[model samples]
Target: MRQETDPRDGDIIEYLDKGRLRLAVILAEDGNKKRYRAVSEDSRELVLTLRQVTHALPKQLSPTLSHEQLGQELKSIRLRAEQLVVNVDASDLWELLVGEMEEVELSTLADLAHGEVSAVTCLSTASLLRDDTIYFKHRKDSLYEPRNHEQVEALKAELAVQERRTQSREVFLETLVKALDSTPDERGTEFDKVMTDPLLRRYMEMLLHLAVAGENATDTGEACELLEDLQARLDHRLKGHASRKAFHLLVELGHFSPDENLFLLRHQLPAEFDDVLEEAAAALVAEGPRRLREALELGARRDLTSLNLFSIDDLETQDVDDALSITRIPWGWELGVHIADPCFHIAFDSPLELEARRRGATLYLPDRRIPMFPVSLSEGLFSLQVGELRPALSFLFEFDDNLNVGASSIVQSLVRVSHKLDYEGVEDRMEHGSSALDDDLRKIYEVADLLAHQRMADGAVSIDIPECKVRVDDDGRIWVRQRRRDAVSRMMVSELMVLANACAADFCVEHHLPAPFRTQEEPDPPMDERDFEHIPEGLALAFALRRCMPPAITSTHAGPHFSLGLPAYTQATSPIRRYQDLLTHFLLHGFLREGRVTIDGESAHLALSQADAAMQSIRNVERDSGRYWMLRYLEETLDQVREATVVEYVEKRGDAALVVVHDTMMRVRVSLTRRVPLGEVVQVVVNQVNPRADTVAFRLAT
Candidate 1:
């Protein structure tokens, strides 16, 4: 127990009402009743009370002044002063003590007491008073004792240490933020020494962990703030190991995709498709030169070199897969289609075969070509170069004058290419009959035309969409060349390939062999036959037809391909470029050699299933890379007005219409204020293009 200190006149005390603190001054005291007449410091209105008062003032006080003089002095002070009353009994005061709220000083309260130091600096509460001494409980929920000067000094010293520590931490945090803004190479030796400190390293590690945890934070704004803060601290050059770690952390935080970052930073694009090349090279090295020598010996090859076989492809084509030869027989003509025999060299279930299966098709890009097999075989030994005797899987067809097949046979044979001609040269010879082998070229064109006409009559759909070829000059300028579409040479080659594939499909079905066949379901009929007639020629008609057709897919069972007008179809061409075509060659060669196919239905299904993922990857690489280069092209020809035709209005993409530039053959999205009818030609100016994001924007020309 402790004695309570009696307050004289003009003393300031805190009145606690429902845990609220109100500072009141004692104007007069009644000794008999032990009560005081006080005026509130804020209101200056006198009131009588018996409630407990808290001593929040200093121990030293001015001598008691007469009530009349006190009232007059208070009125003058109130007129000249700004009122700042701190309610000490409130929870806010407790928050300030624990450093959870803004800092407050006892000196500010002392100034408000107007020279009555005891009224503001005392820490004793009236509730704990006993007898005539004021007391304080050292521990919460404990008995009180008379507060001493030594205890108060010790408490003040502890609070001073905490304030200094807080100020030091704030200075360190500000320095760290400045260091993050500098590039790793630009950061001076001073920063390097500061970062080596153990305390600083611990703080940095803690911040990194906090950023990772924010990846799944419910508040997106909070997550973004954390990422932005961390990014600001990253070194611009990222030369150090820790800087590189920070770069990867920012990437994982979803700031940008890996491709966008690589392009923006001018780093080399990732060669994800090169894994197939690595696996192929390893397999070839393990097999050694002896295996290659054995493959070239052609011990099982049939001799068909006497036939005048020839191949026609693009001037830049390297993998010559199919060749054509024809001989006049008693009925009509014997047509022979020879495909390079890669299946014979690469055995089934071999390492090379597995690698080829993993890469479903060779990816073609503007800058480079990724071959399915090594160039040594695809463009060298196994390629059907002129006058080179190579092993081939030959499809021989005996067709009548009406271009109807009477009998067909596939055999493993050795064929010598008599001549290699490009599409342009073939077209020239076909039109003017100027070549030395004019009769042979003319006869082949006649048969191709008849085959194409018959197939179209059988409901074959031809979508002739032209694509632009991207070329890079020595000085790094991009050029786009639109490929010739629906040319006589293109149709001639396409019809022949279609004829051979149809025969191969018929052979598989007739022999009950298991093979993966290309199939397409019948699409919905057009609203009217005249709707297609109203569409413009060339690319516009092709776009309209493509929108209505379902995508072509491969399946284990043979089905009708409405697009090709074939009841059954299986691709057997381009064995060196496409794995599915190679698989077909393997099946056909096995049947030709052993009188039956070795592949079962289950194996065929597995091949198709495995091929789906690889094929999708190839398509994505081709499509994205092509668009990247196209946008790069637009970057060079900025603000140029180009003629374009509205191919279709895409309703799902909000007010956008798909348009094709006539000169560049580039498809772009145009912002449309109103619906634009299909096939309407319009002028558009390039507004913006971003190669990293593969986006291009166009504005309608006035």
Candidate 2:
């Protein structure tokens, strides 16, 4: 039965041409094992080898005869296929060929008879019929067809799963809505309470303005005044009476004095909440002396008769950088600002300092912080402590109410801090109408604001982007939360810093000092101002081209930073964490005390090279950390599908794009075709989100 040959059997013919017959033992039973040995080769190899015998065979013989008959047949096969060596079995070549031919249709056989067929053709009539049957089976099994009860059940199961997922999201949103509804009022006098909370002083400062909107009102303003007053009271209640209404009333009624500002800033509140600002100031005053003493032991030199100091960190023995001195001169009272020489004390090659340099600056995170200096120095001896004499490089300038500096002095001096202060305590007195330190601070703020206003008016850009902040509870669960910045906190810090930066920059430039500038440049208004709601493609295209174009001068006045609305700015505060500030301190110290510039043209060139690389590394690290936190935050909030815009798209090869979610810039890989428009919102299904890599992959949902 194994070897029988029939002329009509295609399998038998194929076996006769390519397969070899073998003798073997066969056992047949319930449990049986048999062994057989047979010659086997690839089907393509067998056919090619057999084709070699064509020329040698008789002209009248069938063309399918074996290649061994003719030398010419062997030569032709070798020449045609150099890659494959073809060989045929001695015994079953005829049977195998005949078996292979069994499924060929009669019409195809007739075509072969007419010399119209090629053995190596990719598709055969036999294969076509089989494919059609398979396709038909697949179609019948599809969900739309549902050929059987089991398949129908499976389809229903899938639909149910989708419905449950959607319902889960709806439920989550409902809970969120309930939480919002439970709040008594959206805006409340919690601003008053913030004045007492150290960490929340800035937050309260912003609310106070809203709280006292109509303290003084005209008869014509009653309608508007009543509405604002009601709103203020409502907000105050919602905030749980965070604002101090009685104190605010005093100031509004002109019964408070500047003396009250100083008193309240220093006074302790009822021991209910931990005031971060007062704690920070106390820490500075308490621990700053310790750090300064260490600096002295390390060989720092200066007279300590007049320094004033403060800290923003809770005392934890960290390095401190700022100190101040006030001196009485024959002409007038002179004020000097001094900062610690962290670099000098740290040494050129110490591991601690190297790490600090690599970090470029300290990074402030929501729940934790990464300081540039070790806690020992950042919060301790190097800090300027109240009532403790410390050495410093100070800048003294003579200016009156008009805020013009005439005669200035820079000297290495020793000084002591009279008191520690914070934004909240300061703001409390400012609005409550106090006189303690009001005149001095108000004067200072007026100068700072004037300088900042000039910069903004000069085409500097400042954007007010609100942010959501995360607060954690004691149990490691996320709980209290609020918008990140308020007006008083934002403007006060901004104006003061800008003025200091401008002064530092001018001083450096006048002395031909080289320093890293905190520069902002204006982008075309169309590019910066264009909203996603209706983007102007022409403007976008032009902006992109400009970004790609090289500049003639790499360093030119960017005019006012379109973002900050400032013509020029550079930071000269917070030297402990910010590298620019530390370097500025170094340069200013030399110019003021030694009458010399620290960085000349050559040194500046070298500093820029090192500084640029350091800055890039720091930015990348910061971005990566932020991305990681954001991804984790999203995973927890995934059930809530908040509306978002498409801010950016990263191009990739061959039908794929990485879409950046608006605001966070979290990127997700997505399939792309010519159909998708850039910077347009489209619903997407998130398949995976990885916090480790800070990435998300999604498919188009609609």
Candidate 3:
């Protein structure tokens, strides 16, 4: 159906030049290999390889033509090809040929498209195929492949988006400029005025994304450019990276609150349960009681609900993780540390587990508590609610009066809390007198104090720094409370938790089970009591020994934790909150129940990797959000002289010193205009505080 000519010297050919087809006439053949010197359509001279030549037209022209004549001939051929290009309906040609074959030669396309075989028809068909985005793609040797329906639709969607972006960019920019001059009355206080527009919605979302990702953004798109140009128009002028600029712009546009919890967005910690995940959680919550009842009835778990178990937490605590019970055994004391077992319902790598694993741990912010599990389960089923039967991973420790652990064992159990006690209530009872459970509380504290002394003898470095719990009320009021570490209730709870974790780690090691063990390498230079005897028990002194303490790591291997004074340990408490602890429960529960592996060593390490990736972000969001609220509190107390103690000089960051506010015990960095000795208390005035930016600047009041 088609014919073509071998190029001697005068034939014109269609060839690829920078991915576009162009008409070029052969000026001379270079050698026996078919390489030729040719003049392109624009009369540029170049050597053409055979691979570059799309095809040779059957028509020939004079070989010894002048450069001007060659240019004229090329232009005429291009004009005819372009005119014939309009006649080739590419979509129709695709419809005709798609059912026939996957790929077709250029001459076949020409015959199908124009009902004839000629240089003009071939050139026209190739040009149409190259230019059309939705129909076909160029294959090798002048073969063109028609995209399938799905591929064509995908290309059409992409091209449509590109078209919308190209068409909307200038228009959106114009609307944004108009918005800058718009008064509050014109748009109303509600941001729905601007968010109603789809383009502006995308623009604001991109701004949020850029602000969250900052320099780590994989692609800034035109968001930064648009922001830069907006700032340029404002003449209110800023410089440097556009992330901060984006944040300020959102606030200016009234799209974001001044005290927006940006850390939540920046870290992308989930703030609410997704619908599908929430449904799964509801199903699990509905099934939880049945599972526990069956386990208890079948004697699969220890029925310890009859024991006088007690839970101690803060007054506002709902998602309780651990409860305590104490009873005297014949040989020694038996202390039961019961923990809420969320993994009893959560399957391995299930959707809820995956979400919890990605979340790393429950996040406690000043104004919000982002629960790792949905509230349907976390605060309801999995929480050790008072007087309710709940599944638990219980650790029983048998110890002598000397605080010596004689024997320790872990078991899955069902527990009913007999009493719910707050830290203050427990501490009040311990300090004064109580009518009920006085012996149990005192015995537990006695064991805790004795255990602490034993740990001190074992070279444990105990540094208890008081924390500030900041809360923001619905009325925009900030409350900061000094949480003391010296409370008897807190101290005994801490000691017992450490003991349970140590025993759990020992259990894993004894059984040679793979669990998430928390280990810390020894400090380069060990710290002793002498490091603290000189400094007062203030901010820097609290960190005297802890400063040298290495960070604890969660791994599948058993190792010594220098800070805990334990040869090996793992964190098995807070399974309701920490995914690592959930992983531990899974490993232990599987082994203790079926003597089989649910999460093997490889899977434990994989969960550790996934949790590690999100744990740092979770921690960063926690600390940063706390600081944001603390700064907001201080913002209300601006220009007030507050006492701050210098913790240490942060030379690595700048000429600054970290100081802890005496009232709140919240640590912040202050720029040093004069030398300040470590642990030196100074009066400072808060000059400016922006919680959104997490900036609090202070100067010496003296």
- Worst lDDT 10-window in candidate 3: 1-10
Tens digits of per-residue lDDT for model 2 on 1-702? Answer: 122211121111112333432111111111222221111222122221221111111012223443233233333333332222122121122222342432433234323323333321111221232222311112211111112345435655876776775564344333323433344332123323334554344322333333333233223232333234534544543321223342343243233321122111222112121254335435555665676577566545565553334432223324555543334456654545565555434433345444555556665443445565555455554456566565555555666545555676445555666656555655655567455455445544555566566766775434333344443334545432333233553465455555456667667766767756655444444444344344334323323434532322212122233445544555666767776576666667666646787456565455445545565555554554455556566666665443333433455335565554433434566675543555556565556776633466666665
lDDT of 3 at 122: 76
lDDT for each candidate structure: 0.66, 0.43, 0.81
Cα misplacement distance, residue 346 of candidate 3 (Å): 2.3
Q: Which residue runs of candidate 2 sit more than 4 Å off their true CA positions?
A: 1-338, 343-355, 365-368, 385-389, 393-398, 402-410, 418-425, 433-435, 438-443, 467-475, 478-486, 524-568, 639-702
Q: What is the C-alpha RMSD of each candidate to the true structure, in Å?
A: 12.9, 25.2, 9.1
Query: In lDDT terms, which candidate is top?
Result: 3
Local accuracy of candidate 3 as per-residue lDDT tens digits, 1-702? 011344668877877788877788888889877688988878788898877776777566786887678878888867888999987678998898776798888888888888887777777777788789588888765678988999888998999998898667666666666766788555343346446778657776787798777667767867888887777777855444788777666666666677777778877777898899989988887787888889889987889988899989989999999999988788888999999888678788889988988988989888878898999888998899998888899999898866687888889899999889999999888878666597789989998898888888897877778877889878888998888787789999999999988888888888778889888998877666686676777677876666788898888999998877899988889988898888888888888887776667888898888988888998898888888788778888886789989887787456588887787776677776776667888887887887756577777776
Candidates, ranked, lDDT: 3, 1, 2
Q: Which stretches of candidate 1 lie over 4 Å from their true place?
A: 1-299, 401-404, 473-475, 525-527, 536-538, 649-657, 671-677
Report model 2's TM-score to 2 decimal places: 0.46
Per-candidate TM-score against the hidden true structure? 0.63, 0.46, 0.72
